[model samples]
Target: MARTLLIAGTASHVGKSTVAAGLCRHLADRGVAVAPFKAQNMSNNARAVPRATEPTEAGEIGVSQYVQARAARTEATTDMNPVLLKPRGDGESQLIIDGEAVENVGAGEYYEAGWERAREAARKAYSRLAAEYDVIIAEGAGSIAEINLADRDLANVETARFADADVFLLVDIERGGAFASLYGTLELMPEDLRDRVVGAAITKFRGDPSLLESGIVEIEERTGVPILGVLPYDDPGLPQEDSVSLPAAGETALYGDSSEVRIAVPRLSRISNFTDLEPLAREPGVGVAYGPPETVLEGADAVVLPGTKNTVDDLLELRTSGFGERLRTFSGPIVGLCGGYQMLGERITNAAVEGTGDEATVEGFGLLPVETHFSREKRVERVEREIRGVGPLAGALGRVTGYEIHMGETALTGPADRPFRDEGAATEQVFGTYLHGLFENRVAREAFLDRVFEYAGRMRPESHAEPSPYERAGALVADHLALDALGVSHENMSERV
Candidate 1:
């Protein structure tokens, strides 16, 4: 039986996911058999994990839980995230339970009829994981103090109650009003739930700790909960769980010289698998920025259209926002992944399957001579592809491994260049593929970036010397956390032996 600990937040994007991931890594390093859980996650950014019954069977879970499981040195399973809601357009979400998509439902309908089933799914998954791991670090969503939604908040209050988990309330100081927010959250929470909180940790603090000493003391004095360690604003550079964590618009990259190759990603309203850009952002002399929908594609060396939860709707949004118009005229190295790939085609058939109501066909960007048709069946699996083509990114000739999660099948109409030979098209500088984590493969990224820099008349910098993002996350957590207070004791391996 695993002992559970809850990481709850004062508000959304207050570092709950990062804290849980850090704790998972820290505990695993201590030889503790750890796992991560989130009863319900509302994010389009997801990762496919294996099923417990059939290891070969694949299913989707929140990306944060998947990464945390990796940090814990365990194979990711759907039990880690029992219920997932990928928001589609028109106030509806594709509800996934026990790692499979059941149906798409509106917000009101989901609460009225679907909440109980989701709850049961979480319970069963938690029970299975509890029996396996020695410790489970559960993550809570949004503000735990959302009074109106408390009864239906599956991730926070309900999880703590069912798991008998001790809570660590996290407040983001960089957002300002950390003390007030923490105090208000604690005050608003129900008494039974409030009693479960062990302490409050202030996150994203930029200044010295001593400056907050008096404030922390006052907060502790006002509330029964003590102040835990204050974590600095150092980003461990872990994969963010949601698009809400994106850097401010137009502030995506710190622009510098012509030597830097800037990649512009027009921010999609329903962007999914955003972590696909993380590897590119980490590349030496490369800057990845999220261009607003209306912004003109001017200075970027290359442009990437990212994956989306609702392909038709997001594509329509791009057109209405005028980005599609600018994109048609812009001549640059452009790449589209998954849903974005579908949008680059000439037309999309069976659009009603994606909740477009009666609309059967929608116009695409027409960059590639391809057509896509939506279907009830979804493709979600890990894949390794060989890059072959005579197009722009053909230099990226290697075995590229990634995953595909989409509801549409794109067929190239004319005899054109295929980047992955079978999966994607590469017409001149425009590339489209279904692979989500395409840049993670260094060989492919190197080949692709070499062409991009050559096209931009710039020199690609040498390989980055910084540690991998995951390594930095592990070190950051180990340094900032108070493990003793969290009931984790570092034990010598020899002693265990």
Candidate 2:
């Protein structure tokens, strides 16, 4: 029996994904061979996985499951994500199956056909992983309580049904209605599915589990389901899913107490492509934190000026917050990616498109004399280029593929002033370029982090532990499943759901 676990949320931000990832991490540490799953996830954050047998649409994979794969130490994103949806503006989304896009369809019509297709895709994907790992921990879509919608083609309950998922987990905590949310979600799920639910968990609990002990009892009494556990919030080993979603590195540090070394990243309104600091957080003596612009990056190692969707607006805010000037004089290694890269330059074009039907340009910080233009043809493909001379990053980018969903084309003012011939990995202090997942390249992480530590006046610790992200993600899934009231173990990974 291949055991399958489902983590359904009480509400959107009730810590479903975060909780699930943590569980996966713990399980992997326990030597449980685990795989992470999510039936359907809706987000623009996607990744490239080439190992899947059945070809889906290229550029249609969500990076959410990829996060779980990393935690579990899995390498193939295709093996983890078989179906993905990238939403386009007006009521329609791009359908990506098995890692490739077949076509774009209206949301309603897609739902009319996406479930069975998604189930088949996920099941097949899971089957491949199941052969390799012992257990698969899955995540559910929006509130299972969302009745009318789930019936159509939502992957949550449908996954439980089709995947033969053995255990169901209700993640309820953040929103005050956790108790009701859990009970209600359980009650609304199909009876057979409900019976299969292993247990309910109170995740992301803040104060104390004792505070909710009584409520837990009442919950068990009402649903006839056991309260598996109340997991206290641990601040370590957690990575930010996407830049828009603020990342809390578990505030985890491997060999240090970073109470002394502090780093500040702006809480930008529309921040994008912020996976930059994953490498630093894994450094032995480093600590990463997010804060407002008021905090002087003083006594801090460096400041990261991440990317923004609307550069003009975010740049204006950066100037207003005085971070713009601060960056110029920060005297440390200041770096930016994509939109952030544009801001560090002379000016950014496309300001006119802010609201008016006109195209416009906005002056950048003028640090790098590069100009960018917005074009109709957006580059959304995997890119590979060699870094010339910026920092210690001078090497051939070996399949250093990353997605480029940007509308900007950059041109350096002169030959000597190119921002990025490749992607900015080799740039010294004040480097900016349009590349995502820059550190995903082992060479990039080493090159960038080495320069970064030197700029911070610290010796890069030799004992640095570069995390095998997919492995950590998988272990977390397994831990959650074991703690799950369902008592799922590696031996049961073959169980239907």
Candidate 3:
């Protein structure tokens, strides 16, 4: 059986995922067969993993777990994330058990009835992985000391207990209450669970480590917890687990030059698979700013509607927030992916697929001459399709590769020209497709950006696509953490694995 180490945060987005991923890489480098486990994950950013039922194809898992598995040099599986709750809207989410979407459930009903079944599923998955690997690194969700929800918090307390994991609690110094938060969390933790915590680490610190030494010493003396390490504020280019990690709009200028092409993405309430924006954000001379609906679309070269968990609800949100009206009036290059693609259609039928409701048909943005109908079956597959651009995007044509995870089928309502042959539809400057990672393919990405640059009266800058974000993240984790005290030997670390 494999030993376990659980990374629990003082609160959400305090770098638990980063630490866990780093540990997975560090341990793998030691020639240990390691794997990552999360009892539950609530995120829209997900990746396809190998399915146990179908060994040849891929199934869905939280993106963090998928990336962690890659860092560990192991094939990702649904067992890594047993319960995935993708928030739809209005206190409801789609429940996924072991890579399969089970049903759309409300929070009240889920806690009252569904949690036990989901928890049991997680236990079984963790047990299987424990038997197969040498080490299992588990990640916790939110604050581990939320006494109100502790009994039901699968990621923190239940995971630690089930896996017998040595716990490492992480606090974010950037949040300005590190000492108090850590103390309060430790004090609130159930006595037995508190004993499981062997150490604590401060993350996102910005300054000299020696300055924190005095405070760290005092906190350590008070709580009897050793400070493992103080990680610097370095954006190691890992995919953020949630929207909370997103910076406020205009926090960083999208471009240094006023003439550079700037693209605006509406920060939808239920945005999913946001990694689609990462590739575009990495391009030189292009700035990607996530703005709220009404304001984000103003003064931009182009607008992109990202994937959403609940198309109908988020679309409704757009209407309520006046973005739909703005989208209709805005005369600029527009792109929609996945749920966004569904929203640009004339209408959405079978709304009950999103939840238990009588709202069967919801009107879309009517930007494209297509209609969508939701179905019980979800289309989840990796695709490599050749695409040719149309209208103002005529120059943007190439072989695009991406994965699709969506419900509903989109069909043309009229005799309109299709984009990318039969895979997508477009009209003038407006385009829609079910493909995420639309900008990751260099050929397609450069072409689309070139069109935007042309429209904005600026030459498209050279592509500076760097190394894989996962490799950079692993290296950062291995460099930042003091592995020796954490029972990982650094001697010949790169050579051992």
Candidate 4:
């Protein structure tokens, strides 16, 4: 059986995902066969991966696990994330077990009727992964000390028991209560699980590490736990795990200000797969901003309508807020992805399938000459499409790889240019596609940015190559973390063997 290390956080957004990912990369770089696991996750940001039981079929897993798999240098599989819960508002979430969609259930219903099944699925998945890998880095959700839900906390408490894992607690000093949070978390943790805590690490420190020397020593003496490391507050530009990372409504966040070109993204109430915009945001001169529907589209060189969990509801909200009209009048490059693509069409039929109302049909923004029809079946698959070089993607000719996870079908209602071989519709300045990671492709991204820069009458910034995020993360952990304390050798595994 593989050794398990549970990366549990003191609280939500305390850098658990990043710490897990960094450790995965660090171990993999030492030639250790490591795998990432998350028993359960609640996030709208999901990625399609191969199903464990049926390798030929596509299944969904949380984006953090998918990214961690990459960091570990292994193929992403549904076993990495056995159970996923995607929130859809109204105190309900769509439950997916073993990479397949089960149903939408409220919190009470899930705990009462679905919890056992989810736990069983997680157990089987973990067993499979343990049998294959030498080490499994498991990530916990939220706080490990949520005593109110301890019995049903699949990702943290239950994982600790079932996996017999050693826990590494992570505390975020940026939140301004590092010692108190760590002490409180250890105190509140179930006694059995608390004893499993091997060490604790404080993350997101801004200033000199020497300043925390006294506090770290005091905490260690009090809790009898070693302080593993104090990681600096540097982002390696990894994809965010959930909507909590997004800017709040009525707020605008701008990333990268060196360039005159700016692309505006309206923050959908239930935005999913917003990682598609990260690659563009990484560009030197280009700026990507997320704002509310009412004001985001104004004064932007280009616009990208991101994917949404509930398209019908978001479209209705946009129309009522007059965002649809603002979008129609703006004469810049406009692209919509997935649910956003559906919203760009003339109308959507069978809308009741994914909507809150009984309406059979709904009007789209009419940016594209296409119509969409909602269905019970959803498409979730990794795909590679040849760029047709139209609209925003003009002059970009090559294949781009991405995934599709949507609940509707779209067909053209009038003449329009095809953005991909036979998928998506486009005009001179408007484009729509079901492809989720479109901008990740260098050819496609450069092409789109070139168009946007031209429209804004600004020169495109020179591009520079950088290290891969996995490599950077590995270096970060290896340099700062005390691997010896965790029973991981600093020497390469291959060399030691």
Candidate 5:
């Protein structure tokens, strides 16, 4: 059996995912066989991993668990995150149980009838992971102290009970009221769950740690909890777990200003896997900005339509918002991914399958000579294919790996060049592909950047290698946190194993 450590947060977006990732890397560095688990996660950002029960089939898990698996130096599996709730607008969400899409249900229905099944699936998944790894670093969702939801909370309360895990509570000082939130959280948690907390750490502190000593000591005295450490504010540039990390719509967020070549990405209403643009943003001298459909193309050297949860709906919004008209007049390199690919086609049939409306067909932007048909069956699989090097990928020629998670089938309706064998359609300056994480490939990223810089008549800056995010995260945790107090040192290796 494996020992478990649950990383619980004070609230949503308080750096729980990052802290969990850091601990995963830190433990892996100490020769411990570790794995990441999130019993239930609600996020639109997801990645395809092999299903534990069906190894040959690809299944979906939240992106945070995927990143944590990488940080732990372990292969990602759907069992790492057994239940995922992808919100499809309104009050409903698509429930994924054991890496398969079960059904779409509203919050009330899920809690009333679906939660029991979800909990059972999560229990089995965690059991398998515990048997395989020496230590399981589990991440809690939202706040561990949601009193109203304590009984039904699978990610926090239920996990703490079933996994018999020690808890490390994380509070964000940047949000202000750090001590109050920490104290209140501990106070509100169920007695059994609260007793499981080994210690508390304040994260995202900007200034010196000494400034917080007096308050930390007082809080520890009042609550009978140890203040393990205060981590200085620093982002390791990991993939964001949800859209909460993204800038508000219509706001232009420029990553780097050194490069004159700007790649504009429209902030779709329900963007999914926007991590695809992170690679481009990481490139030197290149700038990737997310803005509204109307003005994102302004002064942009290239345009990228990102994947969305709802293709027909977002496409209709783009057209109504005048982005469709602006895109038609822009003479620059354009690329569409997944739902974005469907939007680039000539038409989409059976749109009712994925849309909220009753429409059976919807018109696409027609940038690519392709048509799409929606079906009840969604394609979710990891794929590797050769680049045909057409259109925006003119000079790129190599095998690239990515995953496809979508609800439609697309095919060419007219003569057009294929960008990735038969996977995507392309013209002279437009490209559309269902592949996610395309830019993660060096060849594809370089080729696309080269074309964008050329179109902007600017020099592409020399590339430089950066440190791995996992290594950075590990270093951050080791340098700041008191690993000894957490019983995560080399000396206790035998005991944990």
Candidate 6:
């Protein structure tokens, strides 16, 4: 068994992932064999690392592992995103273990069948990663302070004690309820496990970090635990893996120069498996921006409709948000994967699944000659196969390998005359499929970029694809943290007898 330190947050988005990654990288900088783990993650921004060989398990994936890989200073995406869940609408999640789809299970539906089974899944993954490392830093999900959800939640307070992990609690001071968050957390903490915690932390501080002294005093006086390092908020430059249902309406990089190729992604509700665009965002001339549904798509060479957790709800939301109108009117090349593919269809029959908080067969925009339905059987695992010509996906129809993790299945409504070499044409303006991470491959990437480049009326550089910026950024953080010694390394673990 490896020495494990489990981190939990007072609430969501308090930078738990950031702290875990930082510590792993910080410790690994000293040559320590350290890894990161998250037993259950609800984020839809799944990254398919070709390196993970384990069978994809249901409702399991590790985005934090990517953070640890960076900390360990390695270029292994698979070592991080080993288990993934690309959610399909109707409370059913597309369970993927080790980059492969297994089946779909609804929220609180399959767990009743077994808890030992889920624990075993985590144990197996932990064991596999433990074999290659010395210390494993684990992260827990959501607020651990919720008394009602303690036992049922797999990644809650009980899990920390069950795993026999050293606990580190984090509170987001920026949320304006720091005192309440800290007090409530300690009050709700299980008595037997209170002693297990080594320290509590403050995250996302914008103003004077020194102001944390008073907050620390209050928490210590109330909870009787010491404060750990007050991590000053800094941009680690890595994209967040989020499970947000509402579309994020903010632009990061939609503008600079039209001469530079820009990829606009509609900030659709319930977007899942969003990590697909991380590779594109890292490209130099390529820019990835997010914003409100309508405005986000205004200026761009190519627009991407990413995967989603709830496709119907998101489409309904897109319609309400005025984005659906813009999408139909937009002339630029549009590409969609998984849930996004469902949106570009003639109809999405909700007879099997209800995503928009309703249980009715909703109407879909008659774009692509296709329709979709939520299925009990999920396609979760990875497939390194060819994507043939269909719809707007003609010239680029070639062999490209990626994973398929979605709950809904889509088929063309009718056969077309325009002989799509790989298949029949759904239409000319829209292209979609069950595949994720289509642009990671060189040939497919170049073809996609060529379309964007032409749309932008500019020529792309000769060398199009390159290494991800996260690798470079991770390496930089690793080097910087190495200066301050924390005593964690492969050699530090045992004498080389």
Q: Which candidate order results from sorting by lDDT in descending order? A: 4, 5, 1, 3, 6, 2
TM-score of 2: 0.74
User: Stretches of candidate 3 above 4 Å error?
Assistant: 56-58, 247-259, 352-360, 389-399, 416-421, 465-467, 490-497
lDDT of 1 by residue, 84-156 (tens): 9998867989999988889999999999999999999898899999999888999999999999998999999
How far off is model 2, as Cα RMSD? 5.5
For candidate 6, write residues 1-497 as lDDT tens digits: 66667878889888777767776666665677777777666666765454444334322255556545666676443434434555565677766554455567786765675444565666566667667766777787788777877776556564575557777788877788877887788778777556677777776667776776787787788778777556555656565677442344554444223348777777765676677776666555777766778687767667888877777778888888877777778887777778887887777775446464655576666667777877655555556665554434456666776666666667678754232233223456667767776777666666666677777788676555443444433443344332222223345454320
Q: What is the per-residue lDDT of model 2 for residues 372-415, given as tens digits with 9 covering 90 to 100? A: 77654444565666654353343324445555556568777743
**Prediction 5 global C-alpha lDDT:** 0.90
Clash totals for all models, in order? Answer: 0, 52, 0, 0, 1, 20
TM-scores of the models, in the order given:
0.94, 0.74, 0.90, 0.98, 0.98, 0.73
Worst 10 residues of 3 by lDDT: 249-258
Candidate 5: pairs in clash: 259-285
**Greater-TM-score candidate between 3 and 5:** 5
Considering TM-score, which of the candidate structures 2 and 6 is the better prediction for this target? 2
Alpha-carbon local distance difference test for all models? 0.84, 0.63, 0.82, 0.91, 0.90, 0.64
Query: Which is better, 1 or 6, measured by TM-score?
Result: 1
Q: What TM-score would candidate 1 get against the native?
A: 0.94
Which stretches of candidate 2 lie above 4 Å from their native place?
1-3, 18-35, 51-60, 82-136, 172-178, 190-193, 205-215, 242-262, 284-289, 292-301, 309-326, 349-357, 381-405, 417-428, 440-487, 494-497
Better of 2 and 3 by lDDT: 3
lDDT of 4 by residue, 62-105 (tens): 99999999999999999999999999989999999988999999
Better of 2 and 6 by lDDT: 6
